[model samples]
Target: MGYIDLEYAHTCHVKSVSDVYSLGVLKLEVLIEKRAFSQAEEEMNRDLASFALPIIEAGNIEETLDRRPVPEPTPWQLHALKHVAQIARCSVKFAGKDRPTISEIIANPETACE
Candidate 1:
């Protein structure tokens, strides 16, 4: 459910944007070190995107980051993490038009890092 695009589900067709949404879910899973569906998560947040989007949008990405690493992320790494979250957030918008193009996603991190 977390990896599926709602638009594709209803329309019974696949689009490029559907891939973007799935990428967003994948990013969320990586960031949180959690699977797309996790029994460990709360009922409402069993879906990784649902659990993460709010935190990312709220600028509380730190709360959703995987903390198991021996040393926590540095300030610079935190900035990069925020940008990645932003990309994921844009990619997962309910309306496909609200998402960025693949080209835009590719261009973003480069510009954002500069």
Candidate 2:
């Protein structure tokens, strides 16, 4: 659950989309095994999603991923991770206008990402 839900900001007023955004953030949290906000001193308590978006946007997915690798995951796992990150990136748009609707979010992993 994110403290910064879309409802809190009037600029974007889509409830289902907001929920998708939260899910995206949760995906990152679960994948990276870190809090939503990073406590690492250098990061200055930045939100993990915020910290990761640039990395993902830069096409550096591995850097934003959990540091502890699991004996080299399969290619499909890596692809799925990248796809989930893309979904997360779309979900956490600063403006709701840019975020995907819940329906799109639901379909992306199975169709769009594939």
Candidate 3:
């Protein structure tokens, strides 16, 4: 999938969050080594974008974390990941008016709390 496909789908309305969703899904796919979507109906109902919200909100970002051994990401990196998760949550809000503009998100200071 690419930007063109998304643009054609009118998905650009929440493009940034959708991009974040895609990244999160890809990361989960890599971690699980299987498409979590196929096994559970609930998972299928909620796309990757929606699926990540609860996990992130629960502050269990590491629960289904990638299994492959890799160097630990710094706290800054984890904070950045959480920030993206927050932005994605805001972006995917049902009402477009509720979504934060890119500028607003950029202006906010990063916080360590989930």
Highest lDDT against the true fold, candidate: 1
Indicate which candidate wins on TM-score. Answer: 1
lDDT (Cα, tens digit) per residue for candidate 2, span 85-105? 888887787766677777776
Look at candidate 2 and give me any clashing residue pairs: none
Q: Rate the local accuracy (lDDT) of all candidates.
A: 0.78, 0.71, 0.49
lDDT digits (tens) for residues 1-114 of candidate 1: 679986787788888889888988888887778788766635655777777888887899988788877348999989878888888887778777777777767766544212
Position 37, candidate 3: lDDT: 49
Q: In candidate 3, what are the lDDT values of residues 32-83, reduced to their tens digit? A: 3445345366554434545655776787765655546545657876665556
**Candidate 2 global lDDT:** 0.71
Model 2 / residue 60 / CA error / Å: 1.2
**RMSD in angstroms, all models?**
2.9, 3.1, 6.1
Name the runs in model 2 displaced over 4 angstroms.
1-3, 10-14, 67-69, 108-114
Question: What TM-score against the true fold does each predicted structure earn?
Answer: 0.84, 0.76, 0.50
On the 0 to 100 scale, the lDDT of residue 75 in model 1 is 95
